[model samples]
Target: MEQFIQDWGYIALFLYSFGGGFLALAIAGAFSYAGDLNIYITVIVAGVSNFIGSQFLFYFAKYNKSYMDETVNKHRRKVAMVKTMLKKYGSFMIFIQKYIYGVKTLVPLVMGISAYNPFKYTVLNAIASAIWAIVIGYISFTAGKLLLSFADDFKYVGFFTVLLVLGILVYSFKDKKKVKKQ
Candidate 1:
């Protein structure tokens, strides 16, 4: 991973973040925290990648509206709810779509297919991407830093903690079963 990042630089970061989603962005952040990459550059690349990928999906949905409509029609309630939200919120929906689970791809595509202004979508998406990148990147970087700090100690402590939890769970299950049998 380090080697790939080192060799490919920002291009690799862009590609990875494009398809890899949040997990990929987090990994990039971890690398940045580890001093293998630059955090600011990583965040920018991640934001751009997310924006491009989302736009691609939006265009695809826009171009294939008929087929998408067929699929969307299968879930009328969900589609209606999302449409209502988009109608009420407009560009704000696009800005915060990335933060909402299950709607990241759908919202953008829906907006595009609905002919919601492309300029607004683009502007809001760009802003959202930057915010997402900054927030997620910082979280992953801090997590990575903490994990590295506790690397050696966590190995032993984590192992025992897992064992202790497992033991308690097993004991509780057995006690319940024994009571039921009695």
Candidate 2:
């Protein structure tokens, strides 16, 4: 695996990086088996992959408005709120939107569906994805290290940690909304 990555150079790294949230998981696994993987390089690969993948999805969403409308219609109230945030908050929301799971997944689609601005989306998406990749990668990597130190069953423990982080993010966002309404 290490030899393959070394031979493929940046291209191999890019694919692994762009392979969604699982990129970090894969990186952790690779690191355990191969001593050649560097955290900095892994983070860069993940960040670039995230930027490219999200941008691709964002454009797809833009050109396919009817699809977005159909999917988004189910969450009418949330959609309305998101639309308002996009209009008023614009770049800021685009920057942080990628960190919020469901919100992150739908944001590019939402951006595509409403006043689709490619340049703005591209810039903000790059910035946001890079930041998220670095932060999450570091956190996951650190947790993986700690887990490995504790026991041999580190992978499953790390997996649960990732799930826990995702769950907390989702729960907190929902709780925030509930509090806002009350």
TM-scores for the candidates: 0.72, 0.63
Candidate 1 per-residue C-alpha lDDT over 1-182 given as tens digits, one digit per residue, 9 for 90 to 100:
56887677677778866652787777777778888888898888899999898888777888999999898888778778788888898778877777776677678778878867778777877888888899998998888777556765678998999999999999999999999999
Lowest lDDT sum, 10 consecutive residues, model 1, at 16-25
Q: lDDT, candidate 1, residue 72? A: 85
Error of 2 at 33 (Å): 11
Model 1 residue 164 CA deviation in Å: 18
Clashing pairs in 1: none
Q: How many clashes in each candidate? A: 0, 2
Q: Per-residue lDDT of 74-94 in model 2, one digit per residue for the tens?
A: 888887777777778877987
What is the lDDT for 110 in model 1? 83
**C-alpha RMSD for every candidate:** 5.5, 11.6
